[model samples]
Structure formats: C-alpha cells, structure tokens
Target: MIHLKKIKIVETSEGYGEEVLKKGFEFECGHVNLMVGDQGCGKSTLLRMISNNSKHLEITLADHVITKGIQSYYFDTEKDNPRVKDPQMYTSLSGKDEGIGYVGALTSRFRSHGEIMENMILDPLKDAKDCVVILDEPESGLSIKNQFRLIKEISAAVERGCQFFIATHCYPLIEAYDVMSLEHWKTMKGEDFIKLAREKRYDGTEKDNSD
Candidate 1:
C-alpha cells in the first residue's frame, strides 16, 4: 500500500498563487485526509498543486521521497468526467492503469448525476491499492443519502490500502473524515465544527470565493 507521510508546498504559480497557501504550508499526511473550508479558501488549489507534478514541492512517502507526484490520480468534479473512457488517464504506483477500462464498461449503467459521481469516486478504489486518489467536491451531485454512502465506501477503500485526499464542503463528509481546515490550517472534529459551519452559512459570516 502507498503511504504518504508528508507534503510541503514550497511554491505555487498561477490562480490565487501563494496567497492561498504560503510557501511553508506543511501538512502531515493522513490515511483519509479531507480538506475543508469555506468556498475559494484554496481547498481545490491545494489539490491541484499536489496533482500538478510540480518540481518545487516536496512529497515524502513511507518508503521514499519524490520530486513530482505524477503517480497520483486526481479527479476534479467540475472538470473530470467518469463516463469518458480515457485509458491513458491515470497510472498507479504499481505501474498499472488506474482502472479506466472498468469505468468504460460500467459507465453505461450510470445515467444520473449521482450515479456518475458515485462511479467517479468508487471506480478508482477498485484497483487503487497503492494509489493516492484525490477528489474535489465529489458530493456535488450526490444526495445526502449518497453522501453518507460515499463516506462508507471511502472507509472501505482506506481499509484496502488506498489513501484519499478529498476536498469538499459536504457536512457529512467533513464530520466523518480527518479534516484539514484550510481556514487556519486547524483540524476540526465532529459535531462542533458542523454546528459552526452551519451557523456561518446561515448567518452569512463566511466569505465565499471561487476555488
């Protein structure tokens, strides 16, 4: 299984730049790391940076270090479509295709938005034993029921040795995972964080930016 020990963003270019995350923002990795914060708080930007295969970043795995994380699989909810069969898309650390062929075979059965999103998030877990799967707001089209169901699927994947880095605003997802709050780089736990998040959303206290 692939184990990411740490990641430090030393530099970033374009779109929000270093303001989103300073040069020294070092994050200790988790089995299932959830990046949570208000909209445009650099959640997606951080994910993009990790998947950019940048040379300026430092990625430390359990067994070795790498300059670029090209082996990581990134799925942007707004940009990446699971229905599209792109066999050359992602490759696992084990040097195998990250199951895009399976997506082609199964995407025909998923016609709804929720189904597509579900397939997008779950299909990789099928063969991603030593792969790092990064997902950006996968709950965009999923119902609340499916959101919780996705959480369950994630937990199952974790047990199977697939590490996840998910960026989302879904309360259930935030409450269920190990959250890295981008607001202050503070970690928030269940219940209280959810309460504060809800209050902020209803009272118009949190600022929303395009991430």
Candidate 2:
C-alpha cells in the first residue's frame, strides 16, 4: 500500500495556495483515505496538489518519496486528467470527450454524468493495482443510490491493492471511509457528519436541499 504519512504546503508557487491546512497536516494511511468538507473548504485544492505530484509540497510517505515518480492516477468528476494520458481518455478530464465512432458517441452523447463516471472512472479502477487513485468530489453527478454504489466500486479497488485519496461531501463516502475534515485537517467522526448530512447541513449550515 502507498502510505502517505503527511502533507504540508507553505507557498502558492508549490501547489494549491489554500492555507486551510495547519503546518504538517497528518493522517493515518488506509485503503480508502478521504478529505471531506464543504465547497471552498480546500478539499479539491489539496487533492489537486497531490495529483500534480507537486515538488514544493512536503509529502512524507512511509513507503516512498514523492519526487521519485510514484505511479498515480487522478480522477475528478469534472476532469479526466489521469497521470497517464491513454487513448481512452474521457470528457471528465478534458471538458471534451475526444472519442470517435460508436463508443465515443455513446459516451459523450447518450450517457448521463453518473453513467459516464462509471464507464470512465470506476471501470478503470476495477483493475487498478499497486497505485494511488485520487478523486475530487466523485459523487457530484450521482444520486444517493449511486453514491452507495460508488462505495462498492471503491472498495473493490482497495481490495486490488489500490490506495485512494478522495475529496468528497457525500455522506455515504464519509460513512464508508476514514476521513479528515479540511476545516481543521483533523480526523472527523463520520457518524457526526452523516447526521448533519441527513439534516441537509454542511459546514455547520443548513443547506436548502435534502441528502
């Protein structure tokens, strides 16, 4: 397993300049590691920095050094920027699906966001091995039911020796993984967050919609 001991970003030139993290933010490494918070709380920023493998960021790994080019994959529901740019890249990364013919047309035209994620994200993860997979708000386009289903896909990837770093607010995801709250970069109790989510509260404020 890829054991990420800690991460610290001191300057903007290095990575996401968000200063939400205290110096030397730390967490225990696990099969499914999560960074959870409301929007603009720096979750995506941290994930972005990790995905870029930013040299300026101080990332202490129990197993490997960050500069040695560890094989990693990054997936955002909004972007399909995987570490390796294969021919099968999807619109989730580039804002445009560059596929052609039947498969391409189907992916870009007929599929909903959730279906597209399943085809482009979860499908690749099904066979991922011995690498880190980073996801930013992966539950963006899924329904509550699909959010739970996403957990199954992620769990399968974990069983295959793939370590995951995910940024999310989805209650199901927070409930299913070990999570840190970007609000303080401290361990968060999933049960508490789940209770808040059920009440449509995020970041301690009541949201207008239900979970």
Candidate 3:
C-alpha cells in the first residue's frame, strides 16, 4: 500500500504572501482514489503537486520512498492526442507479415477514442503493479459503453496492485470507485476528505453530483 501523509505549498510573493493548498491531508492507497470537485477546486492542482513535487511531499510505499522510474502514469484526457504512428509500429512489430491488409485492419480498429486509449494506454498498464495512475476526466470522449469498459480496465489494473488518482466529474465513473470529493477542499477543511479517504471503498451506492 502507498501513503500520502501530507502536502504543503507556500507562495512568498503571492497575494496572501503564503498559502497552504493542502496540509496534513492523508489517504491510504487503494486500487482507485477518485477525486471529484468542481472546476478550479484544486483537484488537478493536488495531483500535479503530488506528481511534480515529490521532493517536498511525503509519499511512501511499504515504509520506503516511492522512487521507481515511470511509477506514475498520467493520462490527460483533456488533450486527447492520438498517436497516429504507433499503429504502424504495432502492426509491423506484431510479426504478421501478411502485408498491408493486416496493418490496415489494425489501423481501422483503433480509430475510436476509447479504442485508441485501450490500445495505447490501458493495454500497456493493464498488468502494472505498485504504481500510480493519474487520470484527468477520462470520460471526456468516451461513450457509456466505453466508460464501463474503462472502469473494468481500471479495476483489473487495481487488482494487480496499481493505485489510481483520478480527477473526474462523470457520475457513472464517480459511482464506480472509492472517491474523495474536493468540493470543500478549497475551504481547507480536511474533515470530509479524510472521511472519504479512510473509507477506501465506493460500495456503488453513495452519490455526490456536485462535482
């Protein structure tokens, strides 16, 4: 299991001279840690701070610092950039020397946004363990069926011991994981966040649509 015991940020020259976006925020790592909040509510800010400010934060796995290279996989769904070159490589590397027909078929199959994510993102990390996956609103371009598929894929990865930090507003996606709602985080009140983090299980019935 992984643990994030605290996060602290300071701005010396900003309006308030200094501010703490997060302090003593704690969560036990699980298969999924869904972060839900309204726009500009510091959800993405927290993830970025964790991913980039490793030097200043105290995050650990099994009593040791998490120092593995590429231990975190971030999928910024807002960008939606497709890798047009990878399909050619995938076909050629697949060793199916059946020529252009195979390549064409493979290319056509991954045209949808969800299929591209499955082939390019999820498939590669499906079996990953003891790592963190940070996704920002992955439901952006996915259909309901594809969203369900994404949930299953994430769950499978979680079963393999992967930890997820997802920032999303999709109701169905929110319903599918243990969520920490940031609706009140901007107020710097840690009670609600702590409660959700400690629960660490969605149970599929709790609902919070304010995000």
Best by lDDT: 1
The candidates, ranked best first by TM-score, are: 1, 2, 3
What total of clashing residue pairs does each candidate reach? Answer: 0, 4, 0
Alpha-carbon RMSD, each predicted model = 5.7, 6.0, 9.0
- Per-prediction TM-score, please? 0.75, 0.74, 0.60
What is candidate 1's lDDT per residue for 112-146, written digit by digit as tens?
87776766665555555556778899898898988
Cα lDDT, model 1, residue 114: 77
Flag clash pairs in model 2: 79-92, 79-93, 80-92, 80-93
- How well is each residue in 23-119 modelled by candidate 3, as lDDT tens digits? 4555555557777765666666667656665443455544444354435666665443343332233311122321334455566555876665555
Query: Where does model 2 exceed 4 Å of error?
Result: 12-17, 64-69, 81-107, 196-211
- What lDDT score goes with residue 16 in model 2? 56
Off by over 4 Å in 1: 16-18, 64-71, 82-110, 201-211
lDDT of 2 by residue, 39-132 (tens): 7777888788877766646777764545664557777666552322343654332234544445565445556767766666666666676677
Of 1 and 3, which scores higher on TM-score? Answer: 1
**What is the alpha-carbon lDDT of model 2 when measured against the actual structure?**
0.68
Greater lDDT among 2 and 3 belongs to 2
